[model samples]
Target: MSKTTIIDKEAARQIREGMKADCTKCFSLCCTALNIVASSDFSINKPAGTPCLNLQPNYSCQIHSQLRDKGFKGCTVFDCLGAGQVVSQVTFKGQSWRGNPEIGKKMFQVFPIMEQLHEMIAYVSEALSYEIPEDIADKLSIQLKKLQYLTELDADDLLALDLIMYRFSLNELLTIASNFVREKAISKLPGNRNIKDFDHARVDWIGKKLEGKDLRASDFRGAYLIASDMRNSDLREVNFIGADLRDVNLGGADLSTSMFLTQMQINSAKGNEMTRLPIYIQKPSHW
Candidate 1:
């Protein structure tokens, strides 16, 4: 397998489009495959492989419109990144677990693996969206193809995948891309004297008040930012991969160019109409 494949802008866009969830094409896999713990996000505890009580026979959520109001905020935050549709339509050849009782267990098992592969693909696709160096773009394109190939594997092959190792390798590439963009953005900052002060990778900022700060191009990977007040922050070009954004305030913040920000992360946080998000991420309806 080649380690470098050039993906054009249109191809990259299509790859990203494929990663967005389309619930109409899915079999409500998340409702059945995931174990829900009773928390503020979920109204009740449901065992894995057991369909939620609100799941209709047609595989649609009975209370889809009222998920958040009904205390099913977790459901609203969950995104399969188009994994469910791929597993249902491609992997299993349009077979429904409900119709084919024998495939139910295996289908449930494959969904999560497919979700992870799709996620890696989505991130790599996003990295490729940026105007990075040629070497990094080639490497990201290669990783994107590799992850997409993994999603096409059989259920057993997906189950056998060493996701930890793949994630470790992919994270290195993503970090390199992130640093390149962040450094470039920081260099262009006016006065340009406080460059060394922006490195906040993996820091603890839980419940901290940081309202209206010029936080452009900061490295915040794996940071604990739960419940932080980050309203009106200039978050452009900042890296937020693996950052715990639950309950964080993003009201009036500009995250238009934030690196590796996912729909799930944005959905978990508190944001309003004024929060500027990346073009790919939709503002949460509840916001």
Candidate 2:
């Protein structure tokens, strides 16, 4: 447990804003650190720690505008949640791996760790935005402080962290907060006394046709929703933490109040202009 800092709504908003990726401040760490398998998503198979073929000397993607058209759809969906800039500027002190080849390996390793930490911070910050019980809010605040502190640590310390354990602990609080919010939403639904029916956490719905369904306040945590057709569905207040939304059709769906739905998830899915999204998430240009 870390020293708890009281995070008001405004502070939570600021924390989330700081977690957005700014490529100009980054050194194209994702292009080098992550492995790309040759699937429909990627044009080529690239090993970890190796730079992508499209990476330029200035760390900009050569095929940036044509990534999807150039058979590199995977690159389009990946979002580091501002971890690249934090690693490049703060962790490595504004050093580029290209300039200092010796730091490349370690910097690559640290990037993923920082990405996960930032994601956890984003989720906690989102939880704090809701009207949860004070006890849960206090615990979430402590966890947020701990995660923020971890991000500022040296590379070795970050590599030594047990992220699985941390994720498990943080997920407990997130689950509670999600349940609190969903329950309130469910209570307002017409004839919505069957609470157990909405507990669809971790269900396998891959490629299922769920068009125009009333799935409001449902818990889809860790669910595999790949290629599922959820067009025009009522997904308001649904908990989507860790749900695989790849290629899911959300055309005309209303997710304006969805919980824990990250930008990465939304980017991977197919949405139309009519699809209502949460205020924090931006609609993908491809949609």
Candidate 3:
């Protein structure tokens, strides 16, 4: 692994906390800024810049509790990644689009940009929390600070920001962080699988029965694991970055040491009481 600045536990915790969504301070930006397509995930089609019909006067979703039950599963899965509060409070000084109709369009446009920046901060903060080498940790820490500074920018500054360059820089750092853990994982795998083409590394096991399988150190990044039966499987140290776990069966699955498994992903998945998880993540009330 490469050498980088090491961010201590306290600093990492602060970063993570800032990236959490505080909806009480937000103006229902997600419910307004983004468009929703009519599908299994959503009950109705909503155009961008318009509030959903269920949005209450106080910016609360009227059907929030029954989103999944009423065919708006996407709303349940959606997270603003702390963007909503930042834009509502910092950028606009607690102003709402309704109060200032002229800024409504611009606010909607900036919401998505802020969302991307905040998401990167979330990923970068998670990477920094790992026990990596000093040099790599240092680099991650530097990048984390940069993203944090970006989040504090004013609306005009944020709107003028070059997102493409920032993404390239952040992705490079994250890829390095990912590879550091992946290399360690691969080294621990048994010799039964082919070195050139490991089935665990590239298999499309979506909707497949992988119950009780030894999937240690496998790379499931960006793979479609939707509806896969993974009961009692050994997912120790597996890379779950970008993996889709929506409706995936995780009954009795061991994901206690899985990497990059976010709370959003876990909340969207179908897990039972027996499914083990990382100590830091809280189990969903519905599960």
Candidate 4:
């Protein structure tokens, strides 16, 4: 196959949804700096900090299409917060990387911090709008502004940023963020809270981690589980209604006669013909 592949419009659109201009500033740097090891989803010979042989000059992937076949599943999981462009557009003024080894090294060092700032931005932005009480809105807003400032920094400024930036009295803001996550999601998720009022009769676990845990016959209704890992766990007849299960992992789990486990969910998760049928699943193709 060729060194690179073209990203289709659908892929580009999906990337753009989570990608903000500020966030993408970091991704470009990450792409250039980080080395991804070859695995089941990416090729077998690569390392961090070394540019991927498949990367085009403009930071686009060469073998974008055959990623899985090339063993680059890790690439799909990465979310750069526009750190690339930040380094390129803000720090170096776009005059150095290709010809200057010293500048290239500095850009590589900046990737991690910008990525962290971008992640914090996502969380802070989400918290700002999640039902925070009016009084605490100002507190959250202040913290949000601080975090936004952290995103615009060059490598040196980011490295020098102190922990004091996160030292804010955000008790109410935290609660609002937590509750928003809980109410919109199932009571049980990666970050679970066993509140007395939680109605476990029906729950969803989209993109959660219950790996090697006991959750047999759990009622799940109106859940949005996208990429949860339930490896080698108990799941006999678990109800699943209105769940957004995109790429859930149910390897070595059981779901016999599970009510409401839809075909889409079944196809998305792991299952075999010998695996207890979920009515919706016609024997899986891989297993």
Candidate 5:
């Protein structure tokens, strides 16, 4: 992978001080290269590799205020560990993906790798903040140095990098993520009749532990599913527009072919490979 020089002190301070990190330095690659689909959390549908219509010329989300109402719940869930601002300012020196459309895609492709590195930084920093692990200090130093290098590389070098190097550190951090922050908490809220594309007369959610539930083609318009556990529910062809699904555990829910649902909403919900979403609702390239 290409070496990166994006770990400047200003960027580092954001991670250290903001709890929330901005990767604006790398030219807002996430906003430009990524598509945000519509779902219960976000109301609009976005296509892959296409700049979101909701994204402003400044590369900020135009609907940041009403993200939840518009079906952008996923955006709310993501924490970049200060990657955006750093990538914008430190690595690429504030150049935006918009300036060079062809190179833009390449920059976008490099983003996930950098994001992974930063996530580790956040995880490690969190650990050090709680209590220093004296034995892990040496290991942590090595990773920090690697993290700094990973941010400065051009797209070509990043693509060429041997993932095994980053994987070594990542494997160690994954354990920490699992031990300290595995699904800290989740809640499932009820959807209102805000969006109705299915018949409410022929469905049932009462007492249904939806985790892994299979409801493909079932009508679920205006259902009161508050606190319902639908984590891995199979909801192909079911209607969920206007559904209130806050705090729902949908880690592995399958809503492939779900009716009247937008990509943004699907992206908003919590999911994984097990979480079946519409074909349009692309799964995260990362695990």
Candidate 6:
């Protein structure tokens, strides 16, 4: 991995664009297929395949504008990665589950499968965008195509697919991609900040107080940084692919150059307007 091949900035933009949720084009599959629990983030316990209480007749959330204030903050953080619309419009041909009860259960089952495929596409796209060796990039591209192809399958085919196998293959590619980006980040750092200081594979900084630390070019792939204090941290070129960011403090943290930090992760974390985010994520009004 070389600095010249660190195309994550552009690659992140492309993946985010492709995965951006378009509620208008979707049948609100997430509000129906997924289960919700009563917690700090949710207001009630909803079973799988059951429509949410706040779901409207038009397949939209009635309280979409006030989800957080109404104790549905979890809803705000969750992303279907464009699978909701793909399942609703593409797989089902715009035939919603509302009037068709027979296909409703099937749709519920397929929605999650499609969501998983879309999630893989998101990560695989990022992996392909990294600056790795040509052989690895070619392999990643093949995996990416396979994941994308799965998203285009019909309900029965999608349900019959072996997700565990696909996941295993994708995980192998993701490991390669994660390592490539992390090594590239480390190469850009000064001599004193060596690679040994940071955890590359699965850094465990959970609940650690790392405020204002110089964490430039650190590998945070699948790192557990939940509830960690990272305020004003120098996170330039840090690879954040698959990192747990829930409740992670990012006040004044310079993440403008961070790699693979998605909008969903940013929304879940505790950040102020002063937090330096990548160009793709808008500054939340709550911040």
Number of backbone-clashing residue pairs for each candidate, in the order shown: 0, 0, 9, 34, 58, 0
lDDT: which candidate is best?
Answer: 2
Runs of candidate 2 exceeding 4 Å displacement: 1-5
Q: Give the CA lDDT, 0 to 100, for residue 95 in model 4.
A: 53
lDDT string for model 6 (1-287, tens) is 44444334366448655777788988888898998989998989999999999998988788988999999998888877788889988999988898888789989999999987877777777666557777677666677667777788888999999999988887776766666766677777677555656665477778999999998877787899999999999988787878999999999999987777777788889988789987656666656
Order the candidate numbers by lDDT, best to worst. Answer: 2, 1, 6, 3, 4, 5
lDDT per residue for candidate 3 within 1-287, as digits (tens), equals 23334577567856765666789999999999999899998989999999999999999999888887999888777777778999999888888998677788888988999998887787777777776767777877887778889878878899999999988887767766766765677677766543234335445777999899988767786788888998899987677877888888888999987777777788888888999997645577668
lDDT of 2: 0.92
Candidate 3 residue pairs in clash (backbone atoms < 3 Å): 3-135, 3-136, 4-134, 4-135, 4-136, 4-138, 5-137, 5-138, 5-139
Top-TM-score candidate index: 2
TM-score attained by model 1: 0.95
lDDT of 5 at 84: 65
Candidate 2 lDDT tens digits, 1-287: 32345687788877776678999999899999998899999989999999999999989999999999999998889998999999999999988899677799899999999999999999999999889988888899989989999999998998899999999999889999999998898889998376677988889999999999999999999999999999999999899999999999999999999989888999999999999998788899889
Q: Per-residue lDDT of 142-261 in model 1, one digit per residue for the tens?
A: 788788788888888988999999998898889888888887887798874554678787899999999999999998988999999999999999999889999999999999999888
Write the number of the candidate with greater TM-score, choosing between 1 and 4: 1
Model 2, residue 201: C-alpha shift (Å): 1.2
**Candidate 3 runs further than 4 Å off:** 1-6, 186-203
Point out the worst 10-residue segment of candidate 1 by lDDT.
1-10
In terms of lDDT, the poorest run of 10 residues in model 2 is 1-10
Q: Per-residue lDDT for 128-221 in model 4, tens only?
A: 4344445454555566567667767666776676544453344345445444444444444555544334434425565679877666435454
For candidate 6, the TM-score is 0.88
Root-mean-square deviation per candidate:
1.9, 1.8, 2.9, 12.8, 14.6, 3.7
The runs of at least 3 residues in candidate 5 whose Cα sits more than 4 Å from the true structure, single-residue gaps closed, are: 1-19, 23-27, 130-133, 173-287
